[model samples]
Target: MVTFLAIFTAFLIGFLITPVLILVLKRLNLIDAPGGRKIHNGFIPSMGGISFVVGAIISVLTWFSMSQLIEIRFLLTAFGLMFLLGLRDDMVDISAWQKIGGQLIAACIVVVFGDIRFSSMYGFLGIYEIPDAVSYGISIFTIIALTNSFNLIDGLDGLAGSVSVVTFLFLGWWFMQAGMIGFSMFAFILVGGVISFLVFNWHPAKIFMGDTGSLSLGFALAVMTILFVDSNGNMNDYEGWKFSAPIASGIALLIIPIYDTCRIFTKRTMKGKSPLAADKSHIHHFMMRMGLRHDQVTITIVLINSFFIGMMFIGSNLNDHVLIPIIAVMAVILGLRLDVITLSRVKKIHRETPPILSLRERKKKASKPNVNKEILEKVNLTQN
Candidate 1:
C-alpha cells in the first residue's frame, strides 16, 4: 500500500511540478534545441530531471528518515556526480570522456564507501566460492558499465525516467524483501522524483532529462544493485545472505541497459565506428521506424523494460539450478532475437528511405498529386 502510494504520488506530483520545472530550467538558461539527431522543431528545457531529482528527495525525506540518509554515502556520491555532470552537460557542452571520468569516480566512491558489489553466486556456476580480488574487479567494472548504460538508454523523452522509476520500484520491493531498509527508502525517493518528472515528459515533452537526469538515475541503480548484493558480499560475515546466482539477479535488475549497451557496442564495432557514436540505432529508434509515435514508442519500451525486470525478479525465486539456467538462457535468446528483428526493420528503413524523405514526409502535398491525368491535361489546358 505504501509503495502504491509512492507510485501514485510520483505521477501526481511529477505532473504538477513539470511546468514549474520547465519554466525554472528555461529561466536558468538550460534549453535544448531539437537539432542534430534530435527531431524536435523548437527549443525545450533539458534539465527537468533536476527537478525530478529534487522532488524525489522531497518525497523520500518526507516519508523516510535521516538515519537512512546518513548510511548511503555511496548512493549520495553517485547521485551527486551524476547531477553535477548532467547539469554541466545540460548548460554547456561537456566531452564524453569527462563524463566517463566522473562515472569512474562515482563508481569508486560507491565501491569504497557504500560497499556495493557482487562477491559470488549462490551456486549457478557450480562454484559457491569467489576471491576478494576478483570480486572487487568485477563489481567495479559492473558498476561503471551499468552507470553508463542508463545514459545510453536515455535517448528518448520520458522513456528513461519511466523505465528507471519502474526498475527502482521493483528493486525497492526486492531490497525490502531481502531486509535492506535504508536502500529501499533511498530507492523510493529517487523513484518518486523520476516518476514526477515523467508527467510532463510523457510526449511532446516540454523538457528532456538530457544526460543530467538519465545519468543520475542510472547511478542510483548502481547504488541499489550494490545493496542488493551487499548482504551476500561485504555487509556481514554470515550465511544469512547467500545467493546461488547473484549475477543472474543483478543482470535481471539491469537487463535493459546492459543488453542494449552491449548490442550497441557490438554493432558499432562491426561498422568500424566508435562504440560511443550516437546514431539512430537504439531500440527506441527501431520503435520509431515501426511507425510508433513518440509517446507510443516511449510507453512500449518502458513496458518492455518492466516486463524483463519483472521476469528476472520472479525467476530469481526458483531454487532449481537447472530451472534458473534454462530460464536465463531462454530469456536472453528471446531478447536478442527481438533486438535483431527490430534492428533489421530499422536498418531496412535506413536503406530504403532517401535522406530527403524527412522533408518529403512533413511537407503538405499540393492538391493531392493531380492523379487525373487526362482530365488533368484538360484542366491544365483550361488553366493555361
Candidate 2:
C-alpha cells in the first residue's frame, strides 16, 4: 500500500508539472527544431525531462529515510550530474567529448563511492571471482555504455520512454520477488515518472525528453543493473532468490538498446564514419521506413522487449552457456534481417529515382529561382 502511494504520487507530480514546464520552455524559446534527419514537423520543448526528474526525486525522498539517503547518496549525486549535463546540452549544444567525459565521471562516482561494482562473473565462462581492479574497470565501462545506449535509442517519439517503462516494470517485479524492497520502490518510482511523461510524449509528441531525461534515465538504469546483478550473485545460495544466470538475464533485459547500439556502431565504422556520427540507421528508423507510424513502432519495440524479458524468466534455470548463446543468436539474426530490409529499400529508391546531376550541381540548381522563357521575355520588353 505504501509502494502504491509512492508510485501514484510520483505520477501525479510528473503529470501536473509537465504542462507548466512546456509553457515555460516555450516562453524561453527552448525548443528542438525539426529539420534534416528529424521526424517532428514543428518546434517542441526539449526539456520535458525536468518534470519527471523533479517528480521522481520528490517521491524517493518522501519514501526513503536518512540512512537510506546516505546509503545511495553517490548514486543520486551521479544522477544529478547527468541531469545537469543533459540540461546544458539541451540548452546549448555541447561537444561529444564533453558529454562522454561527464558520463565517465558520473560512472566513476557510482563505482567508487556507491560501492556498486561487479565483484564476480557469477561463474560465467568458468570464472567465479575477479580482482577489484578488473571489477571496477568492467563496472565503469558497463555504466558508461548502458547510459549512452539509452541516449542513443531516444530517437523516435515515445520510443525511449516506452522501452524504459517496460524495463523498470520488470526490474521492479524481480526485485520485489527477491526481497529488495528499496530497489523495487526505486524502479516503480521511475516507472511512475516515465508513465506520466509518456502521456505527453506519445505519437505526436508535445515535448521531447531531450538529453536531460535520457542521460539521467540511462544512468539510473546502469546503477540498477549493477546492483541487481551484484545482489543476485550474492544471494544465489539462497532458495527463493537464486537467479541461475544473472549476467545473461541482465543482457536479455537490456537487449534492445545494447543490440541496436552495437549494430549501428558497426554499420557506421564499416562506412568509414565515426561511430558516433548521427544518422538514420537505427532500428527505429528502419521500422519507420518500413511504413510503421511512430506510435506503432514504439508499441512494437516495447512488445519485443517484453518478449525478451519473458524469455529470460523461462530460461532462468538454464546455464549461461546455453541460454546466452540462444539469446545472442536470435538477436543477431533479427538485426541482420532488419539491416537487409533497410539496404534493399535504399537500393530500390536509388534505382527508381537516379540522380540527374552530382550533389553539388543539384544543390546549385535548387538554390537558383526558376524563370520561364515567356516571363524573361516579358521582363526584357518592359525594360526596353
Candidate 3:
C-alpha cells in the first residue's frame, strides 16, 4: 500500500541521512554538551532533526500529488515555518518570547488560513457550539500549548521520539480507516522518519533531535489532533470509525506531555517563578531521580501513554462528559501519587546518604571520559 511505502521511504532516507548528519554536526562542533540540567555524558551531535524532517517532507511530496497538497497547503506552510523556527533556535538560542511569537504565527496560519479551528467543545462543560471568535482563540491556545508541552518532554534519550512514534502510528491508522488519505499519509510519513531517528537516538544516543525536531514534531501533532477532533465531530456513531468521545480520546493520545506540562507550570507559578523556567521537576526527572535509567523511563512513559490510548478505544462508546471526567480524575490521582512518592523517596535518600559521600561519588563519575559507542558506530557507518 502507498501508506506503507511512504513510511518505508521516509525511514530509509532518515536512516541513511542521520549518520551523515551526525558527521556534519560533529565536524561543525554543533553538539550538546553535558552538565547543567542535562543528563547525557560526552558531546552528542544535535539538530539531527534535519534528517527526519527532510526525510518526511521528501516522502510526503513523493507520495502525495501537488493538487492534494493544495488541500493542506497552509498547514504545510505552517509546519515549514515551525521547523525553521526550531532549526534557528537549535543553532542559535532564541529568547522564550521570540520562540513563542514564532509559534503563535504558525498557529494563526493554521487556524485562520487553514481553517482548522475547533468549532465545538462536544458538550464536556454543558457547552456545545462556540462563537467563531471564541473557537479561534481556543484553537490557537491549544496549538501553542500542545507544541510547547511536547517540546518540554524531550529531556531524555528516545523519550520524545518514542512518544511521537506511538502518537503518529495511531493517528495515521485511524485516519486511514476513516478514509482521510491526506492526514493518513502525513502521519505515516513522519512516523517513518521518527522511527528511523530513534535508532540513533536510543540509549547512549549518538544524536539528539534538538529543538528543530521537537518543535516541528509538536506542531505537526497539534495540527493532526485538531483535524482529528474536527473530523470526528462531523461524523456519527453509525460511521463505525467515529469516536463518541473525540476530545477525550485526543487527550489520552497526548496525556503524558500535556499533564506533565500542566503540573510543572502550576508548580513554577506557585513558587513565583517564570512558568518556562528550566527545572528538573518534570515527571521524567522524578522518575530518573527515583533511579530509573533513561531507556527504562522512556519505556515506562510510553507504556503509560499506550495504556491511556487503549482505554480510549475501549471506552469509545462513552460520551465526552463521562469519559473526560474519568480521564481527568485518573490523571490527577496518578500525578498526585507520583509527587508524593518522589518527594518522600527523595527526602529519605538524602537523609540516608551523607552529603560529602554523594558529592565525592558525583565527582568520581564526572572525572571519567566517555565516548558513546553508538556515536562511534554511526560515525564509522557514515564513513564506509
- Name the candidate that leads on lDDT: 3
Encode model 1's per-residue lDDT on 84-189: one tens digit a residue. Answer: 9888887888887887788788877877666676656555557556787776777778777887887887877677877787788877776676676777767776
RMSD of each: 5.1, 5.1, 10.7
RMSD of candidate 2 to true structure, Å: 5.1
What is the TM-score (0 to 1) of candidate 3? 0.90
lDDT (CA) per prediction: 0.71, 0.88, 0.91
Query: Which residue pairs show backbone clashes in model 2?
Result: none
Q: Estimated TM-score per prediction?
A: 0.80, 0.88, 0.90
Error of 3 at 382 (Å): 66
TM-score (C-alpha, index-matched) for candidate 1: 0.80
lDDT of each residue in 1-384, candidate 2, tens digit only: 878988998999999999999999999999989998888889998988998888989998998767667767788889889999999999889998999899999999989877898989888899988999999999999999999999888989999999999888987887888876777887898899999999999989999999999999988888888888888777855634566888888888888899999999999999999998999888898888766789998998888889888888888888788888988998898778877886787677777774777767989999999989999999999999
Off by over 4 Å in 1: 1-17, 27-29, 60-63, 230-244, 317-332, 335-384
